[model samples]
Structure formats: structure tokens, C-alpha cells
Target: MRSRSRTYSLTFSIYSLILFNSLALHASEYLISYRYVVKDSALYNESLSISQAMKKCSGSPQIALELQTDGNKNLKKIISQNSEKFTEYIHKLGMHVEYKDTTNKAMNKSTTIMTLQTTCFTVDFNDNFAKIAPLK
Candidate 1:
């Protein structure tokens, strides 16, 4: 009886390990959107198109995309790593994304916004989104 119990425990442990590995492997599908403003730019006087800015993503599928606090700045590539979550948010907003960043020299993305939803969302990068897997 003891030997049987040990075997059962070992099997359960193996399945748990597999589940954990799967979750980690796909974590990037989700990301927290980071928003901010850049008070240091030449375009201090002009109205920028939000859609046009995102459409200019530099060849990446795009992930976490948001207008900088001001129109002249943009946040790209940062969210591409977690495009899934980003896309989901935009979709939930009743919109589609992947805009252009036609401005010369882009804004630096250092911070990210917190996760928008407690459940799942798209990241808009690789056209995928998933829920934040619970940490072990």
C-alpha cells in the first residue's frame, strides 16, 4: 500500500510540473499596458493622430501600444513582447490596432501600465492574448 501511494504522488507531481511549464512558456502572451508622457520633444505644438502613430510600428506585430502622455510621443515594441494582452484591450475598446509611428525618432518606453483586466485580453503583438497565469 505504501508503494502504491508513493507512485500516485509521483504521478501527480509530474502532471503539476508539466502544467507549470506550459504556463511559463506562454506568459508573454499577456502584458500590462504602460502609458506616459514626454515633456521633452520638438513637436510641442501640433495635433498628432493616434491611429497614424500606432500604424507606424517598425515591422513588429506590435504588442502593448499606447499614445504617450502627449501626442508627440509613442510607446511601441514594449508591448509587442506581450501583444496578446494589448490586442485584447484594444478589441475590448471596440477598435483594432497596429498603427504607424511616422515621427522621426520615437519615444522611449520604460514603464508599462498595469494589466487592464483581471481575466484575459489581447496584447496586439503576435495576434494573441491570454490570461495572466497564476504564479506558483
Candidate 2:
């Protein structure tokens, strides 16, 4: 009976560790700031912004003005395909990205920023919050 109890406790301890690590890996708080910058395109110099880039996105959320990438995939899929490119493009447009919740915005924030704990790509376009993991 003692040995069986010990085995049960060990199993419980392992399960707890896995649960904690899973929670720690994914962060549900993030902030996106809008900004504008000047860049020279093929013909003229113009000021561009993240809102503009979003317009160009071909998904539910746009990335440019009336321009779409011609894809049925969501923003998360696009990022997972090539996060480096997407990250670079957005970064160049004077956008700020944060992964922690330290401000009032985070408290009222609804976007979920998935970290290494979850899937490879996680993005929320609307004001959607993270779903609570079901207890087993």
C-alpha cells in the first residue's frame, strides 16, 4: 500500500510540473502600438503605417489599402509560414510589439499572445482573449 501511494504522489507531482510549465509558456497579454514612417517606394516617397499594412493583408485583417494577398489562411498561418519576414515587415513600419502584461491595457486587453508553450504561431486580430484550458 505504501509503495502504491508513493507511485501516485510521483505521478501527481509530474503532472503538476507539466501543467505549470504549460501555463508559463503561453502569455495571453500583449500590446500593439500604431506608428508611421516615411519610406521611398518604386516611384515616390510616402509615409506608411501599420494600419496601412494591415490593409494590405489578404486575411480577415487587412494590411494595406484595398490590396489583399489572395489567401484564405488566417494571420496565424501567415506568421507561421515565415515569421521572420512578417516580423521584419511590421517592424520596419514603426510598430511596437510587447509580450508582457504590466499595464492597465493588459488588464483590459483581450488579445492572446501565444509563446513557446503552445503552438508555433498564435495571433488574435480582434479583441479576443485566451480560452481557459480545461481541467482534467
Q: Which candidate leads the pack in lDDT?
A: 1
> Tens-digit lDDT track for model 2 on 1-136?
9999999999999999988776544432222332232222122222222111221122132232111223523433433455456445445434432233334744532232322211112233333322111111
User: All candidates' TM-scores?
Assistant: 0.26, 0.26
Candidates' RMSD to native? 15.7, 17.3
True-structure lDDT of candidate 2: 0.35
Candidate 1 lands at a TM-score of 0.26
* lDDT value, candidate 1, whole model: 0.37
Worst 10 residues of 2 by lDDT: 50-59
Off by over 4 Å in 1: 31-136
Predictions in order: lDDT: 0.37, 0.35
Clashes of each: 31, 9
